[model samples]
Target: MRVLKFGGTSVANAERFLRVADILESNARQGQVATVLSAPAKITNHLVAMIEKTIGGQDALPNISDAERIFAELLQGLAEAQPGFPLVQLKAFVEQEFAQIKHVLHGISLLGQCPDSINAALICRGEKLSIAIMAGLLEARGHHVTVIDPVEKLLAVGHYLESTVDIAESTRRIAASKIPSDPYDPDGGFTAGNEKGELVVLGRNGSDYSAAVLAACLRADCCEIWTDVDGVYTCDPRQVPDARLLKSMSYQEAMELSYFGAKVLHPRTISPIAQFQIPCLIKNTGNPQAPGTLIGASTDEDGLPVKGISNLNNMAMFSVSGPGMKGMVGMAARVFAAMSRNGISVVLITQSSSEYSISFCVPQGDCLRARRALEEEFYLELKEELLEPLSIQERLAVISVVGDGMRTLRGISAKFFAALARANINIVAIAQGSSERSISVVVDNDDATTGVRVVHQMLFNTDQVIELFLIGVGGVGGALLEQVKRQQEWLKKKHIDLRVCGIANSKALLTNVHGLNLENWQAELNEAKEPFNLGASDPSGERVSPAEPGDCRLYLEPGGCRSVRGLPARRLPCGHTEQKGQHLVDGLLSPAASGGEQIASQVPVRYQRGGGAAGYRKPAEPAERGRRTATFLRHSLRFAVLYFR
Candidate 1:
C-alpha cells in the first residue's frame, strides 16, 4: 500500500483538482493507494480572516460570502467539466458545508470569543470541502473511491489546534479500518482525523502530517507528497533561476531543509514515515512523470557534499549574557524553561564555550515575548547587574546548508564560510548540531539570498551569480555595466556570472535579476515607469534584504565609509576614514606651504617618516619643516587626507 499527500496548490482550482483526480486514478491503477488532501490554495487564510472578523465584531459578510462563492464556483466549474457528475449531490454538500460555516461564524460573532477549538473546527471546513469535491470528482469519473475522515479514523492527542498523534492508538485504528483494496477504489482521501473523544486538529500543514501518519501505520512502501513544484530544488527557483532539482536526499537532509525553509515538504511530515524506514517522495502534480526527489534512509548515494541550502527570514536573534553565569549549571535550563513557559519556541541556538552568554533565534512575532520572558526570569541577575539586559537584533535571517555527506567530508564547514566571505556576506552567529547534518548561519536579511547563492556555488560548483544594484547609471554605473557586458564571456570562463540585476538614475528604475540587457539598459531606464527610491525592492523578489546594513548614504560622500553613520562632518574635508583605525596617509600632508594650509584646516592627521620606517604618529615639525611629507597614514580616526602639492 502507498500513502500519497496532495497539498493545497495541487488541488488549487477546478482544473488542478481534475488533474489531481487523474493522477490519483493512474497511481491507484499501479497498486493500492490511500490519499490525503489539503484545503484549496489560500482557503485556510480566508478561514482565519473570517474568524478574526467575527471575534473583532467587524462585518464578516465578505468573508462568509467569499467562502461560499469559492466553493460554489469550484462546484460550478467541476459540473461544467463533468456534465453528468451529480452536480445536485455536490451542490448539496457545498451548501451544507457553508451553512455550517455561517452558523459557526454567527455564534462566534455573538459570543465575541474565538477559541482555538472553534478556530480549528472552522479551518477544517476548507479541507472538508476539498475532500468532498475530490471524492465527488473521482466517483463521477466512474472510479470507486473510498473517502476516509481522519477525524474518525486517525487518533491524535493534544490541544485543539496543534495536536500530537497517539502513534500506537493511531496505528491500531488505521489497522482496523478498511482501506480501499480494489484497483477501482482509490481510497478517497479525507481531510483530518481525531480520536473518538474530542475533535483535535494537527496544526500547520496538517494534511502532510496526516499522510505520514497513515503511511507509517500502514507500513506503506513510500509516502509521496504531490505539490506544484517539480521537486525540492537546490535553492528557491523563484530566486535562483538556475537552481537545480534535487533528485534524491536522505530523510534527515529533507527534514533539515524543510525546517530551514525548504517549502516543498512539511517539517513534521517526515518523522512518522522515517520511523518505519519508509521512503518519502516529493513529486509534482503538474507533471506526474517527473522523477521527483526521493527521500530515504541512507545518505550514502548522493555525491554532493551538501544536498541543499535553506533559509528563514524575518527572524530575530536574542542574546542573554552575563559574566556571572560562567560555569553555572542549569543556566541553559532556566533560560529555555522560561521560553518554554512563555510558549516561545526557539529555532536555533548557540552559546559561548565559556558559558558567559547564550544566544538563540526565534520568529520575529515572538521577539518581544521572548525578551520579556528572559528579563522576567532573570530579574535578580539583571537588577544586580550580574546579567546584561537581553540584546535583541531584528531583521536577521537564518541560512542553513544541509547534507549527510558533511559528516564524512572534510572542511565542509570551512568551505561554507569561505564562500560567504567571497560574496561579502557577513554572518552574525552560527550553530551546528553535533550530528553534522547541517550548518546554519545568521545573516542580515538583505544578504540572505545572496548568502544562499554564494554557498550554493561553493558546494555545487555551479556558476556564481553576482546580483548588482547600481544607482548611478551615467558615468560610473553606466561604464561598469558596459564593462560587465563586455566581459560576460570572460567571467563565465572563470565560473562567475556577473549580471547587472538593477540599474537606476535619479528619475526611474529598470532592473531584472535574470540578467538585464546591459546594451540597452539605458534605453530601458528611460522607458521605465517607476521612480527610483532608496527602498526599491528586487522585481523578482529574490534579493534578500534588510539591505546589507550599509547602503549608499549621503550620495555625495565619495569613497568614504558607506554607512550612513559614517557620513563626513562639515568640520572635516577630503575623505572620511573608518573610525576603527587609519592607515598610512600617502601624499596628503606635505611641508609645502600650500599643503600645510590644507593640513592645517583638516583634523589632526597621523604620519610616518619615510626613512625612519617607524609606525605612524604625530608629525615631527623640526625635521618635517621645509620638506615635503612623503607618505601619511591615519589610524583610529574618522578623517584622512590624500593630496599632492
Candidate 2:
C-alpha cells in the first residue's frame, strides 16, 4: 500500500489539484494507494475570515442555499479541468457538502460561539471538497473509485479536535469495513466497523501525520510525501548561498533536521512511521518522477551523504547551573518545566555533569522570558552563593549538520571546524550529542546562516568556506564595517564569508558571530558600547574582516589600554630629564584610537670632536653658551655635540 500526502501548495488550486489527481493515478496503477490532503491554500483562511466576520456581526453570512451554490461553483471548476466528468454532476455533490457546512456555520453565527467542533467541521471542508473533486477525476480516468472522510471512517476527533490512535483496533475495523463509497457521491454511503474507529483529526500539518498514520495502519511498504521543494535543503537556500539538497537521511536525521528548521517533514510525524520501519519517500510535486529524499533505518552507502542543512538564528543560548544542581536529575526537569509552562520552546539541549550546567537555546522572542524565569528562580542561588545565575547571551544562532555517518568518521568535526575557520568565524558554543550523529555550534546570529553554508561547503561545497572576523568598530572600524556591509552583498555573491562576530566599544558589544548586517553595521556599532579584551582564537581564519594597519591598532584589538602604544621617550626642551631621586618624566603615547597623528619634532644632528678613539669633546666653552652647536655620532648610537663661537 502507498499513502501519499499532498500539501496545500501541491494542490493549491484547480490546476495543481488536477496534477495531484494524475500523480495518484500513476500510484494507483502500481497497486492499492490512498491519499491524505490539506485544504486548498486560501480556502481555510477564507473560511476562518468568514467565521470571524459572522462572529463580528458582519453581514457576510452565506445561508444554506448560498453556501451550497458556492461549493457547487468550486466543484464545477474542479470538474472542468478533468475531461468527461460532467461538470453538473460534480457540482451537485459539492452543493451537498457546502449545505452541511452552511447549516453548521449558521448555527454557529446565530449562537455567536464557534466551538472547536464547529471550527474543525468548517476547516475540514476544503480537504473534503478537493478529495471529492479529485476522486471524480480519478474515476473518469477508470481507476478503482473510492473516497473516505478521515472524520467518517479513519478519524474520530475529541472535544477539541486532538488526535489519538488506537491503531490495533482502528486497523481491524478498517480491514472489516464495507466497500468504501465513491466519496464523490457521499449519499451512496459505506460501512465502517464500530471499534476500528477513533477521531484522528490530524493537527495543522496533520496531513503528513495522517498520511503516515494511514501508511502504518495499512502496513504499507512505504509512504510518499509530495511537496513544493525538491527535498530538504541542508540550509534555507534563500538565506545561505550554498544550501544543498539532502537526497536521503535516516529517520533520526530527518527528525533532527526538521526540529532545527528543515521544513520538508514534520518534527514528530516521522517517529511513528519509523517505529514500523516504514520507508518514506519525499518526492517533489513539480517533478513527480524524481527520486527525492528517503527516510529509513539503514545507513547510507555513499558514506553519510549530506543529510540536510538547517539553522536557527537570532537565538539566545544559555547554560545555567550551580554545584547544587550538579548530577541532580531534577534540575533540568525543573528548569525545562518552567520554560514549558511559559510556552517557551528549547530547541537544543545538552548538559555537562562535571560543569553542573545545562545549556539550551530559545528563540530570541522568548529569550527575555526564559532569562527572567531562570534568573528569578535561581537568583539567590547565583548571587548569594552559587553559579546558577544563568549565563545567557543573545544575538546568537545555531547551525548543525546532522548525519549518522558521524559515527564512522574520525575527523568529521575537524572538517566542520576547518570550513568555518577558512571563513574566519568563531564558534561560541559547541555540543556533541551522545549519539554523535550531529554536532551543533552556537555562534553570533549574524553568522548563523554563514556557519551553515560553510559547513555545507566543507561537507559538500565545491569551494571551501573562508571566513573573516572584524574587531575594531570606530572611525576606521566604522569605515571598515561600512565597507564590509556594502561589499557583503557582492562578497556573498562571490561566496566570501566576511563574518563580523562581535563589535565592541568601551561598555557594550554587539555581535553577529553568525556575521554582522553588512548593510547597516556602522549605525549598529555607534549605538553599541560593550567593553572587551580581545582574545586570539582562530576558528575559521579565511577572514570576516581584513586588518588595516591602522585598523589593527584600533579595531583589531578589543579595548584600548590606558598606556599609549609605540611612543618614544622624550626629554624636555629645557634639558630637563627625570633624575634618579626625582620623578621620571615618562613619555609614552596612548594606543591609537579612531583618529590621530604624530607630534611636531625637529631635533638637529650634531657631531663632537673625536681623536684616537677618545670620548667626544663637549661644547667649546659651555654646552649652554650663546654660540652655534655641532653634534656627531660618537659610537653611531648617540650624538655628541660641541658649541662654536
Candidate 3:
C-alpha cells in the first residue's frame, strides 16, 4: 500500500481538490492507496480565530461566515464540474458541522473560556468537512471510498491541543480495526482520542504525523507528501535566489533541516517513517510530473559535503553561568529541566569546556518565560552570589549547515566559518553534534539573511563572481566593458561570473545587481537620474555615489588636454604623479577603499603612455610619467573579485 498526504494548499479549492482526486486515482491504479489531508487553505486559521474571538468576549460570527463561504464556494464549484456530486448531502453535512461549532462557541462565550478539548473539536471540523467533500467527489466518480477516522483508529496521549501519538498502540489498534484491503481508501481527519477517549489534536501540521503513523502501522511501501514546491531545496529559494532543489536526502538530514526552520516538512513527521524504514517522497501537487525530492535510508554520497543550509530567526540566547557551575554534574540537567517544566522549547544549546557556562537559544516570544524559568531554577545560587544572573541576548538567529557527508569530509566547518567571515558576519554562539551531521551558529537577526546567502554560495556554488562598478566611461572603461562582453563565453568556460553591477560616468550612475545589460549600458547610464558628484564622499564607501572621497581621485584627460591634478590628501600612497601630457591609465576600481592596498598587489594591470605599451610592474615610486601610470594602475587594481568554491 502507498500512503499519500496532501497539505492545505494542495486541496485548497475545487480545482486543486480535483487535482488531488486525480493523483489518488492514478496511484490507486498501481496498488492500494491510503490518503490523509489537511483542511482547505485558511480554514484552520479562521477556526482558531473564531475560538479566540469567542473567548475574548467578541463576536465570532464574521469568521464563522467567512469559513462557511469558502466551503460553500468549493462545494458549488464541485457540483458544477461533477454531474452527480451529491451537493445537497455535502451542503447539509457542512451546515450541521457549523451548527455544532456555533453551539460550542456559544458555550465558550457564556463561560468566557475555551478548553483545549472543545477547541480541538471545533478546529478539526475542517478536516472532516474536507474528507466529506473529497469522498463525495470520488463516490460520484464511481469509486469505493472508506474514510478512516483518526479518533477511532489512531491513539494519542497528552494535552488536548497538542498530543504525541503512541505509535505501537496505534499500530495495534489499527491492525485490530481491520482496515479495508481494497484498491483505494482515503483516510480523513487528524484528531485522535486519548485513553479517556477525549478528542485531541497532534499539534499544528499534525496531519503529516497522522499520515506517517498510518503508513507505519499499515506497513506501506512508501509515503508521499504533496505540497506547493517541487521538492526540498538546499535553502529556502525565496531567501536564497539560487537555492538548488535537492534530488534526495537521508532521513536524518531531513529531520535536521526540518528542525532548523525548513518549512517543507514537520520535524515529527519523519520519526515514524524513519523508524519503519519507509521511504518518503516530497512532491508538488500542482506539478505532479516533476521529480520531487526523496528521503530514504541512504543518499548519494557523491554530492556536496553539506546538503543544505537552514536558519531560524527571531531567537534569543540565554547564558546560565558562574564559577559555581564548574564541576556541577547535574547543572545542565537542572537548566533544561526548568525549561521543560515551564513548557519552553530550547532550539540550540552549547557549553564551555570548563563547564563554567551553558548557553541555549529559544524563540524570542518565549524570552521572558525562559528567563523567569532560569532565574527560578538557580535562585539559591544567585542569592548567595555563587552564580551570575542570567544573561539574555535577544534579536538573534540560528543558522545550520547540514549533511550526512560532512562526517567524512574535511574543511566543511572551515568553509562555513570562512564564508561568514568574508561577509563580515559575527557568530554569537555555535554548536555541533558528535555525529558531524550538522553545524549550527547563532548570529544577529539582522545578519541572518546575508549569512545564509554567503554560506550557501561558498558551500554550493563553484564559480567565481566579480561585481564590477565602472567609475569612468572614457575610452579605457568602454574598451574594458567591450572586452568583457566579447569574452563572456570564455569566462563561462573558465567558471567565472563577471557581473557589471554598476556603471557610472561623470554625469550619472546606473546599477543592477542582476547585472545591467552591457549592450544598452551607455543608454541606460544616460537616462539615470542619480547625478554623479565627484566631490561628495560616500559614507558607506562601497559604491560610487555622487560623493567624492576625501583621499584621492584619478582623472584621465584626452590626448591633447592638460593633466588635471588629483585631489590632495594626507598621503599620496603610490599613485602620485606630475605628468604634463595626457596618458591612458586603465585599472579595475575596487569599491572597498580599505582593501585597495591588498588587492592592488594581487591583480596585474597594463599601462600605456605616449603611445608606448609598458608591461606589468610592481607598485613603487616611479621616476618617469609612464612608470607612474603603471604604478597607479597597480595601486588601483584593488577592484574586488570574490571567488566561491
Candidate 4:
C-alpha cells in the first residue's frame, strides 16, 4: 500500500481538498492507498492563540463558540467553491464537530477552570475536526477511508497533545482495527476509528506521526506527503534566485534536513517509517506531472553531500549558568525537572560535561516560565551557579543544510563559510551532531532573509522561482511587497525571479505564482470579486503591516495603503502621488464627494468657473499711468456714477 499524507495547506479549503481527492484518485490507479490528513491551514496556530488567551485570563468558552462560527463559515465557503462535491451533506458533519468542541470549551470556561490537561484537549480539537471532515469527504468521493485517533492505540498524557507510540503494541493494535464498508456505519476498519475518538496529537509534527503510525502498521511501500511547495528546494527560493530541488534523498538525509529546520518532513516520522524502510514522497499539489523528491533508506551518492537549506525564525536563546556543586550528579536533572514541572518544554540544548554551567533553548513564549522555574528550584545554586540567574535573547533565526553526502565529504563547511562571507552575514551559534548529515547555525532574525537567500544562491540552479502568498498588506508588509514589486524587474533582470503567489483579503483570496500583474492590481482585485475578510482583530493586532528599517524601499512614496480589507488605498513608500493640497482639491472636485454641488457654491478663486477668460499684467510705468487715468475717470464720472448709484 502507498500511504499519501496531505498537510493542512494541501487540504486547507474546499478547492485544495478537491485537489487532494484528485491526487488520491490518481495515486490509487497505481496501487492500493491510504492518506493521512492535517488540520486546515493556519487553524492550529489560531487554536494555539486561543489557548494562550485562556492562559492570559480570557474566557475560552465564548472563544470556542466564536471559533465554531469561523470553522463553519470556512468549511461552507470551501464546499461552495469546489465543484462536483457533496459538501451539503459534508457541512452538517463538520458543523457537528464544531458544536462538540464549542460545547466542551463553553463548559470549561464557565467553570473558570483552565488546566494544562484541559487546554491540550481543547488544542487538539482542530486536528480532530479536520480529520473527521477529511475522512467524510473521502468517503463521499467513494473511497474507503478508516479514520484513526491517537487516544485509541497510542498511550498519551492528558496535559500534552502528543503521544509516544508503544511501537509494538500500537502497531499490533492498528493492524487489527477494522473498517465497516457501509458508509453510514460508525464501525470502521484496521485503524483507531472504532476506539477512543478523542485525538491525542504527537509532538510538534504530530500529523506526520498519524501518517507514519499508519504506514508502519501496514508496512506500506511509501508515504507521500502533499503540501503547497514543490519538492524540497536547495534553499528558500525567494532569497536565492536559483534554489533547485534534489530528485531523491536518503532517509538519514531527510531526517537531518527535518531536524535542521528544513520542515520537509517531521523528525518523529523518521523513527517509525524509517525503521520499516518505507520510502516517502514529498509532493506538491500544483504540479502532479512532476516527479517529487523521494526520501528512502538507500544512500549512494558520489558527490554533493549537501542537498537542501532550511531555516527557523522567531527563536529565543536562554542560558542558565552557575558554579554550584560542580561534582553533583543530579544537578542537570533538577534543572530540567523544574522546567518540565512548569510545563515548559526546552528545545535546543548544550552543556559542558564538566557540569559547571548549563544552557538550553525554549520557545520565546515560555521564557518567563523557564526563568521562574529555575529561580524557584535552584535558589541556592543561583548564587553558586553564577552572578546572573538567567540570560535571554529574542530576534534570533536558525538555518541548517542537510545531506548524507556531507558525511564522506570534507570542505563542505568551506563552501558555506565562503557563501556567508560573500554575503557579509554573521553566524551566531553552531551545532552539529555526529551523524554529519546536517550543519546548523544560529543568526539574527534581521539577517534571516539575506542569509537564506545567500545560501540558496550558492546551492541551486533553477528557472522556476520562489513565490510568496502574502496575507497582511499593512505598513511593513505592504511596504515590503511594494518594494519587492518595484524591484522585481531589477531582480529578474539580474537573473533572480520571484512572484507574488497569492493575496488574501479577510474574506477573499487571489493567487497565481506567475504573479498578478502589478500595474493593474486594483482592477484585478475588483475583478476577482471575492469576499474580503479584514477586521480590527488579527493575531498581531498590529493589524498594521510592519514598516521598519529594511522597509525604506516600500515607503518612498508619500501615500499608499496595504491591500488588506478596510484599509484605504494609498501609495507605496517609494512612489509619488498627487500632493495632499492637490489631492484634497481633486477629492472636493469629485462629483460624488461634492454631491453634484456647483463649484460657485464652494469658494472664490481668481478664475471664473469654466468662464473663457485671459489674464495679463501691465508694465510698471503703464500701471501707474492707468491708475491716474482711472482716478480722473472716476472724478469726471462722479455725476454719472451718482446718478447710476
TM-score of each: 0.77, 0.62, 0.79, 0.63
Candidate 1 per-residue C-alpha lDDT over 588-614 given as tens digits, one digit per residue, 9 for 90 to 100: 111111222101011122232222211
Clash counts for all predictions: 15, 52, 6, 33
Quote the lDDT for 232 in model 1.
Answer: 83
**Which of the two, 1 or 3, has more TM-score?**
3
lDDT of 1 at 154: 69
lDDT of 4 by residue, 531-578 (tens): 433223222233423223222111000001111111112332333322
Q: In candidate 2, what are the lDDT values of residues 111-158, reduced to their tens digit?
A: 997876567566667777767666667777766666654544554333
**Candidate with better TM-score, 1 vs 2:** 1
| CA deviation > 4 Å runs, candidate 2 | 45-77, 89-115, 152-164, 178-200, 240-247, 299-301, 314-319, 327-329, 340-344, 363-396, 421-426, 464-645
lDDT ranking from best candidate downward: 3, 1, 2, 4
lDDT of 2: 0.58
At residue 553, what lDDT does model 3 achieve? 32
Q: For this target, which candidate reaches the highest TM-score against the unseen true structure? A: 3
lDDT of 3 at 8: 93
Which parts of model 1 have CA positions greater than 4 angstroms off?
Answer: 183-196, 299-302, 464-510, 516-645
In model 2, the worst 10-residue window by lDDT is 630-639
RMSD of 1: 12.7
| Candidate 3 global lDDT | 0.76
Residue by residue across 380-437, what tens digits does model 3's lDDT show? 9999988987899999999999999999999999989877775556899999988899
Better of 3 and 4 by TM-score: 3
**Sequence-dependent TM-score of model 3:** 0.79
